[model samples]
Target: MRTIQPIPFRLLLSAVLLAPCALPAQPRGPVGSVRGTVYDSLTRKPIVDAVIEVQATAQITYSDAQGRFTLDSVPLGVQQLTFSSATLDSLGLYGFAREVDVTSDTRGVLLTTPSFGTMYGRLCATAGSPSRDSAIVFGTVYDAASRTPLSKAQVSLRWLQSSEGGKELSNPERTTATGDDGVYGICGLPADVALTTTAQHDAIVSGAFNTVVGPSRMLRRDFYISRELGQAADVRTNATPSSGSGIVRGTVRYERGKALPGALVSLIAGNRSTETDAEGQFRLTGVPLGTQELNVQQIGRGGVSRAIDVTARDDGTHDFVLRGTTVLATMNVRGKVGADQAGFLRRKQDGMVRVVEREEILKRSDIGSALKRLPGLRVAQKLGGTVIEATRPMCVGQVPIVIDGALIPNPRNTTTFSVPQALSGTTAIPRATTTPAPSRAAQSSVVSAANNARVDQLMVNDVLAIEFHPGPASVPMEYWPGPPPQCGLLLIWTVASNWDK
Candidate 1:
């Protein structure tokens, strides 16, 4: 160039650095993408908001409402795609993963939760025969109120199986512990048989969650647990298992056609019971939590006993199917508390106690209604059942109930259960040292939970008479089996007194 002779080395370097000429394009490694859809194995429905990750890499994407996802600029080569979501995380399930070749956009990739095949492979790996005869139970245990996963929850499963030698055997109880993910699984269970399962965490335990895995051999049951009212836990004590209670509502009907009205239902060994309404529907509350046996009274059918698993999140529903006539009849006192008609008349004529005669009982629909006829009693609708208390308004608005002189146990006696043990890997609720004074609602709820809805079980036809003692002064020794209640006693006269039992 002009005057370029004898240019300095420094000047030549500066010119090259300042030059605007384009050099050969630098090379880059190949980059690809991943596209796929996520779904639920049980429902076979698309799962939205699932996060897909290119493992060991920085690329990540989330599925849309349609469960479709795409990840661009994934380094080309073999890559691991992981899928996780709130739904999966809450179940304590680690996300699913797959190895994918990422030479180009990997499209049409489908994913799902642990499918039947996958679960089978994992559960039945050591089981014999690779057959679908054995069932697999998998689910998450969670807090009933918060709906959050409960870590370290214990799930108990019990089932009866037939052994190879034609012998009926009770399988060793299968129990599994849940991790922080609250996920649990049991494999190789007998298919097409009823299995009872319960979940427990510290002082909180769920009612029985009975399930049946048919020939399909896949059961997904999500159990919910809660601390029942009247239970108190202290960090100093080991949490005892709760015999939690729940409300069971259902209808009785003839399997062939319509509702069976006036049908009587009672919890076996539990006085908290009820009778079906005119519509054949009944709502029974405060039944103990767990697998409870129910006795249904029907004429000529014998007393039918049915097993129902009472859960914390009870569907609040049940349906009883009867085969015979719906022409309701008198209750069977086989093992129930009944009355002595002679003694009832004797008490009535003595005039020492307030007596509700059959003529009055027959006019009302149920005993609770008949009890309302008494002037010294307070009857109020609460928690889907009739609650009776003395007009004195003491004793927290509840009185100990007696039927046929059989004193029903008062739930208020043991209002406090044990606290959480805080076992390893378990996330327990913290014990509160200080609590605000309970509101009236709280007070009412405690009373309601402690009192049984006895009105639902006895219809007017079943009762010959009823007696009420308004105070300790009037509670006779025969009626008050235990310490005389401050609020007095109620003696219900049934068709057959337990004296016959």
Candidate 2:
């Protein structure tokens, strides 16, 4: 039986071929890899948490602390890589993009994008009527040692704007933050969009987190950004590593013979200026060391100009007086009324004068609210809301308003000048006169209230009557220093009828 088996050559051949098929095919090696680093151009530091995406495959990879990233298993080909960072972007870096080449079989490539440095600044306005969505966020983030672009740093933004009618509005303008690479930008603003851009340094603290402003500091500054009535624009933010700067300190005053309260003071060295407080005092800080032209003006009164030479250690103090020429009239009130001599009292409390009440000062749409209702008088917030001046104006400092007979300290910090004096009660309404100035007994009571921080500067409950003193239409010889500057006439109000009447 063993000898009967016959071997077939065909079967033997088939067995050999089948044996080869049983062997396993080796797994294909990875196609290729894409690699890159997100870094600041200036510092050469890596950017972490930056999102890098492959445009073709829509695959994404986040950069690590060293700003290094790799996309594995990428098919061999040209790939577009997109980079994006946080929206609340930092001062240094923004976003970037580039095309990368990938070879087949485990080959990886690297990409370097542009770095962005950043700057910081603020926004301000001339008048009380505020502008909206006004500000610029621009700057370049750079390396501390090489002064190169530092594309990966965080930056934040906060802002405030003035309100219309000198009244506080509920919401101030707010904006979303932005990110960066070698360059950064965030712009889309309204007429009020003038801002001070500040840059935060990674290793350099002096120029870092400091504000960058206009033409005077142009060598180390980017540009002056202003928002026209209706347009979208951006202002540049540029800053250097130096910190030595000059400052201007002083108070603003009316040329007319008296103190000006609530008069705004604007200081302009180069496109930058801030308003003073009710006392007419102001400070222009961090001014680049140089010669600067300073223009001081009472919004509605009259503006005056001066030139100042600034130095690194300079804390220059200068005062100014604006003139009033033209005057506003009684016709501007909501309900047009003629001039009236009778003083009005607030309906709430009998003893308290209406004008002395905070309600009287704040309730109306403009400064002339209560005054307009009275006969023969009108009021307006003019000087484009910069100055709370009146027409048929009184002499400089001629109008005085006293809270409790004595002047109230200006809320803003400055000593050069006190607030504009309110008109005297007796002068405003001949029939109604102010109560006598506080005697020693009254002073003692005031002291007690002040100690408890309960002193009533503008207590709503204690008001009695308000008096408006009408000034002459023309400037008098006494009101001028030499020759009266041309200006509009303004009326003044004196508070002091009787809060406790």
lDDT values of the candidates? 0.58, 0.37
Weakest 10 consecutive residues, lDDT, candidate 2? 226-235
Q: Against the hidden reference, what TM-scores do the models get? A: 0.37, 0.27
Best by TM-score: 1
Q: 98-142, model 1: which lDDT tens digit per residue?
A: 767876878988866766566555444544444546776677777
lDDT of 2 at 462: 35
Which runs in model 1 stand beyond 4 Å of their true positions? 1-115, 122-129, 226-246, 266-271, 286-320, 324-501
Kindly list the per-residue Cα lDDT of model 2 for residues 1-501, writing each as its tens digit: 001111221232223221111123324454587666776442355667888776656678998888888788775655566676662144323334565666754334444433211211211121123223332344444432334454434233223333676444221222222233334443322323223223333322111111322221111222211111001111111222132245677876666645555543332223345666767677766554333345554424544555444444554588777666444333343432222212222111222111333556555543345444432233333322222222221122112233333332311111112323442333221122223344456544443322112122333333333443221112222222222222222223233432223
TM-score of 1: 0.37
TM accuracy, model 2: 0.27
Question: Runs in model 2 with CA error above 4 Å?
Answer: 1-168, 171-183, 192-295, 298-326, 330-406, 409-501
